[model samples]
Target: MGLPDYIPVKGSITFLGKDITRWSITDRAKAGLTLAWQLPARYEGISIRDYLRTGTKGCSERDLEESMDFIQMNTTFLDRAIDKSLSGGERKRIELASIYLMKPRLAILDEPDSGVDLLALREVLGLLRLLADQGSGVMVITHREDVAAGCDRSYLMCDGRIVLEGSAGAVKRYFMSQCRPCDGCEVGEVMRRG
Candidate 1:
């Protein structure tokens, strides 16, 4: 995905056998590619239902219900605004639910497990698998062991570049070895200030 105010030094991107290396974000979207960012953006005046309706044009009530169910969301949230009023978990779930309904040709999920619980994480994985099985390409960028392990292959990215690419187990082991807590760092800090 292209980041705003920054251009890729060098890279080639192809989606569904089409070269999209120089395509704009709008163009990629028009070609059925979508990205689910790690931090879901909030919409000040948009309702959850309205936001989700963008996933599928003229979305029916039953389809929306099914999508919400797939993401383990309560249908009553339809009227809620897409803003800070919602919890991080709730926002993340809505984003995933939208992705589920979008049915894009390629869905790039960045940290799908960031704000989700065990069950929601499982649902996210299931959604990716379902998408792949249905002829869509799903790419998940996650650091969680369980999440990465679900993939057929995995790539370890370090310093904004790939350091390893192989079986999920191999990359997972390498990632763990390099994940221990260290002094003068907060990578694994979990306790409250004493």
Candidate 2:
């Protein structure tokens, strides 16, 4: 689980039950699984409409046009130039919306709340929990304590291996205690901020 056993120098990965060890990034994306980058990836000459069309098969317009509360409302400003215009949080949210469009069985999000605000962070966490509850397996990799707290279960990866795992609360407690002399510094901040 340590970054999903990546071999960066080789640019290969295997996810879930799929041996994507040889699949291209796009191929992996089309296989009922999706990955959101640690930093949101943006398209240069694309509008949100154009981008969504590519991923969603031109269905976003039909669906969003008919309903108002979906991606449209959530991605209020994404319809503009998607190149270098979006804030990190906005781009991340748009990335999440794009992943939602795929209706994937497994979603791998890398630090989805990297630069998001409190409200947006909560929204993302709530949506992730909902996805997991709805029978989608969500694997979120983050160093943020708040993000870990939102997950149903938690695991700690150190030195390229999973060293600790358990309920989220238990993991948090253990992580907090191991930080030494400043038990309050790690978990206390998480509790206080939450």
Task: Using TM-score, give the best candidate's number.
Answer: 1
TM-score of 1: 0.76
lDDT of 2 by residue, 4-119 (tens): 44446654466766578878768877777777777776587787766666676657565543322333344444467787756675676667666666677788777777788887
lDDT of 2 at 107: 84
lDDT computed for candidate 2: 0.63
Candidate 2 has a TM-score of 0.73
- Per-prediction TM-score: 0.76, 0.73
Winning model by lDDT: 1
Candidate 1 lDDT: 0.71
**lDDT by residue for model 1 (1-194), tens:** 31223357877887778899989988998798888887787766888889988767878999889878877778888877777677776777788788778777777877777777786677767766776776667777765667767777777654445667777788767767875543442221110000
Root-mean-square deviation (CA) per prediction: 6.9, 6.0
- Worst 10-residue lDDT window, candidate 1: 185-194
Residue 178 in candidate 2, Cα distance off native in Å: 4.4
Looking at model 1, residue 19 earns an lDDT score of 90
True lDDT of residue 191, candidate 2: 13
